[model samples]
Target: MLRRSFLKVGLAGLAAPGLILRAQATEQPRPGSPFIVTYFDLPGIKGSRDVTDAGDGTLWVCGQRNGTLGRFDPRTSQIKVISLGEGAAPHGVVRGPDGAAWVTEGGQNAIARIDDKSHAVRLFPLPAGRERANLNTPVFDKKGILWFSGQNGIIGRLDPNSGKMEVFDAPRGAGPYGMTRTPSGEIWFASLAGNYIARVDAETAAFTVVDPPTEGQGARRVWSDSKNRIWVSEWNSGQVSSYDTESGSWKGWKLPGDKPRTYSVYVDDADKVWLTDFAANAILRFDPLTEGFHSFPSDRAGANVRQMDGRSGEAWGGESGTNRLVRIQTVKPA
Candidate 1:
């Protein structure tokens, strides 16, 4: 395992002078747009990927390419980077109830816990024979147990208190990519290769697969809205769809422009749907009430933001290609 170290960086003292300002210079949203966009260049984090609210006005970001995790404070324009371990390519991160950052540590094939206060790193490797499970995402159930997915046909759970872990085969052979917890306490995951979304029984670990309306839509990620509806980003179909878990109905909307490749989907605190489109190089916000889409294209080409999470007024994502963290502050429409 690799040794862990913390590097505190302030934008003012960065060796690459004016790098953050240069990134922000081109980030202005279109004129009259109700959103203000800002970009922060991550000093040492390469592949700044999946991000989640760290609960204390900061965010936890996965440094996939560089094998690290970063705690970013927006107000101070500072970040604290913590190394995971040798070959530790973490994919997804979420702030757990314990105020720690729980990571799907793909490189180590283990679950990692980063203490919020101490910046301590702890690993819980999977049971034998589950090597290279390709861990992707993790979500916590109502009972505080952690559930996670693997691209290599595995669904798993961990009891943080007991230090016990369990892994189960997914319904389809592979492609469990993103997982989310609904307000109703149900867990749902999207299968990128299997092209379906499924619900996991928190108690039994049984999976009930749900097919999207479009075949081969390639459901890459899912987020639950306030109504408990599952919003999916279809990579193959280039559409954003929502499933009404209660009504058993579905709705799909194709993204604007040609060859749109929807990579991630997030439902904001106000129930607004946020999506990242590869083709347009933009972050889109979909208003359910008006059925309209607003685009916030990145000024730079290939801004490929992978995942997003946020608080009440802001949506945050990592610009994996650019190695920057982006924040879009939403101003409510009168």
Candidate 2:
């Protein structure tokens, strides 16, 4: 495994010449000793992009290619699917405030909420008269209102209580992808095309951009630690960067391998950063305490585990390439 370290990046690429931190290191991929991986077959539900807790032992997933939302009980290996109607290419699924699965439906050009049991579907179209939005992922703010991203250069908020939905254009367009709320309750999202992550002011719907250290390092996904610092996965540069919100500093490390393609990032309860390397076809773990990278390669080939979320005990992932939901139980090394 190869590693690179850089810190104290200036905002908007404005700094003394050659002041940017640049160094590289290597790490060996972790073998199958301390990790126990189990997979649940999501039969017939292919192209899963994201997963979220169903508020039960089960998990809800987006069947991106099949135009459906699926609920899978990992304990029993039972899966239930609900058709979001034709042309409903759902991209992200998260449990909503009402204890239901909310979907960003790009195919239907709307936001959808589905009952956990009855699976009844309700569509909330992007503010009236607007063209179809290339919807991406969603995250809820402290007030229970939903904030979402659209790859078509847009962001929006939905008030479930009042059925009021509004859309706003991102500062830089056409790449608003993954989104996560900070511990301080601020919502931030990544701009894949724009190469920056921006924080959203929920009340005003304002976006403030945070640039990554490396130019053209596609900011594909963003997650926050318990301390409210933002962690972002840079797709183009194959690195993970952290923004210390309080100090206004940045630190970044590249994923191991010659051509690591970082697709998703999640920070678990233990403060360990989890990432999916598409090029290596494995889930990589980064321990902040040790500043080391560990790899947990999936047993099945091409287990493209995109978009994961952490819970109290474990982290869940949707293996889109294999059409399965995987739960990883890691034994901490002594």
Candidate 3:
């Protein structure tokens, strides 16, 4: 595999005489291993918090600082910015079945959908008398239903066609965070405050919450693997866990750093798991087949990478604190 390393130097330091940023050596790819890293510096995208692939070669990114939306095309390397209105406080994003991009506006207690072609925006408010929406992560099921987690201990669903809405109560103070749908159409979610992984049956509307194997550890994000197992990131415990849907069993791996604050968890097409260490400013990759681990740090400190999505041997995420979009391209084994 051909491996390369690149560094982003600050303008102030680079303009001072002959000073140059040191080139950190890239990690060597082992035999039968495939992965590489490519970093893109997104200007004016401070607080890039979450990203979703539009499935048409476009990437939609959300901002934490000002609730802005950005569109990027890998082919053209062009980025366009769209304001999500003042105080939108956008978080997780997903492409709805209606072909619009749906986002959780944590600041506004509502869900908004953006037309993919026109960029027209429409807002859907939470049910009357419901607590502040604190709407966070969102995902769409096969039937065109959009589901999202609210910080105020509830899961919400919206039918884009009819604008009908439903809310399911979670345990008090659960703080439901990221969510994903399984092949069976069940919605799996992580609870940052409740410390569990939950599943909601699409047909029956029943809910199940599974305690993490590590007691007292809060799950910040969740993703379903190809094998039908759900993976979760233990934010405070610095660990990753897997729950077997068939056997109702659980297993976990402790991250390298203590109290690492693992913010996001994703499994690529090859079944390898990837995690973001917010405090550590690094991306960690774990190979389930080999049980081996690899770590890559960001070019800049205080990056605070929050969420990610993977596609075509590449992974993209937003740096919430720095307001930048980070990209990593994996170099396949030779």
Whole-model lDDT values for every prediction: 0.87, 0.80, 0.75
lDDT tens readout by residue for model 2, 256-291: 899898999999978889999999988888998888
Cα deviation at 301, candidate 3, in Å, is 0.9
What is the descending lDDT order? Answer: 1, 2, 3
TM-scores, each model vs. reference? 0.91, 0.88, 0.87
Off by over 4 Å in 1: 1-29, 332-334
* Superposed Cα deviation of residue 93, candidate 2 (Å): 1.3
Best by TM-score: 1
Q: Give per-residue CA lDDT, model 1, range 194-233, as digits (tens).
A: 9999999898887899999999999999999999999999
Q: How many backbone clashes does candidate 2 have?
A: 3
Q: lDDT for model 2, on a 0 to 1 scale?
A: 0.80
- The model with the greater TM-score, 1 or 2, is 1
Identify the superior model by lDDT, candidate 1 or candidate 3: 1
- The local lDDT score (0 to 100) that residue 318 gets in candidate 3 is 77
- What's the CA error at residue 219 for candidate 1, in Å? 0.6
How badly does each model clash, as a count of residue pairs? 1, 3, 10
Supply the TM-score for candidate 3.
0.87
